[model samples]
Target: MEPHAARPLEGRLALVTGAGQGVGRGIASCLAAAGATVAVNDLAPTRADAVAAEIRDAGGDAFGLAFDVTDADAAQTAVGDLEIDILVNNAGVPPGGGRPNRFAQMPPEDWQLQIDLNLAALMRLAQLVIPGQAERGWGRIIQISSGASSRGLAIGVAAYGAAKAGGEALIRHLGVEYGPEGITANSLALGLMEGVGRAGDPAVDRLIRGVPIGRLGRPQEVGEACVWLASEAGGLVNAQVIHLNGGTVFGR
Candidate 1:
């Protein structure tokens, strides 16, 4: 393959969760554009198929797989036969039903939901691919985290925040354990990205004002970052959290 060919990820296989729309869909499309055959996983079969069709229409190889990440049996059944070179864990639920609420008022089920989907489910999916990745001597695991994981920017997201923080910790641990085997793991802690989560909420304007960049982040920006991190150019960058919050928060 030519060094600068449009398909740098040619021959690779990637799986992106919650790729029916929003940030997940963007990342899936970007991966496919780089020449990877992509599996777009989403809870809704129709949505997943739509996004996958879009990728195919754009001349990229893609297919939709529907399964709830929190469902272990379903996840295993959907992903068992695939040889995935890249994994992007982007499925998650917004805190308090997309509205801020006091932690005191948060329901127990809400907290457990976040923990199961954002953290535990991620581990389950990673387990399916890490062994193969280690044996093959190459793999990329990217987690889509939130600014709340490390910052106080948002309110009433204690459960979500805690879950994401745990996810970041897991990424660091995975990096250390798998780095020598050529499997890199990292997390992207994003803030106020356009069209993602509750970006259109009235409270978002206040949040955006605090960002030094003076604007909401674009989904495409996140997608490009994923492409780089999953490519050879980012081989040495591991066990790190790349803040995509437009400088809203600094440091780990």
Candidate 2:
């Protein structure tokens, strides 16, 4: 990576949940590129270690922290005593369309799972990381959200939309409460990103067609936003959900 003026995050330690693959992997790499030592956290040890190794091989500093974010005990253990300056709460698992059936057909278990993975775990991390940020008088936390939080989403995904929206609101609440302490929290609202999970599904093509950019969003673009938000250069950026949906909201 070429040198730039805003090395605001150099020497900072960043812990990114869900750093196993896709957008999470991209964000971890972006933070590392900015000279931060990244803790690549993920539920899958193999994916987490692989991403961490990639960062190290690229001449960046990184280590893997493997655990399920939804597990409170595991979260405390994996993030035990971290005086981290940045946190990217990006771990999430899609319902895989099984729960996207009509509301009447949707299973209660699937809805609960979505809520647990996307919303519950994020709030837990905020609780875990805030005290340290408050003590430091300077820190950043960037939550990864979905564009569906504000706009319409896929069929039967009402629960996911609601949960993501709630998480964004939490980011705003923390941003306001901690701003005086020099800690800023923000969120990135994303749309259809290519090359990951159901993102490449044919059904998603219909969603992509609505994007003015005429293509799916890239993981790197979303990662860059997280990197900026976690850096000191973004000191004034707090409590905002910057949509990276490539104009897909034109119809919304």
Candidates' C-alpha lDDT: 0.86, 0.82
Q: What TM-score goes with each of the models?
A: 0.92, 0.91
* Candidate 1: tens digits of C-alpha lDDT, residues 32-80: 9988889999989999999999999999999999999999999999998
TM-score of 1: 0.92
> lDDT, candidate 2, residue 221?
88
Q: Which stretches of candidate 1 lie above 4 Å from their native place? A: 1-5, 94-100, 196-202, 250-252
User: Which residue segments of model 2 deviate by more than 4 Å?
Assistant: 1-6, 94-98, 196-205, 250-252
What lDDT does model 2 reach?
Answer: 0.82
- Tens digit per residue, CA lDDT, model 2, 1-252: 223565656778899988889889999999898888899998779999999999999989999999988889999987868878898988766524335655567788877877888899988988888898898787898988887689775566777777888899999999999999999999898877876337567767776777888888777887788877876667789989898888776211
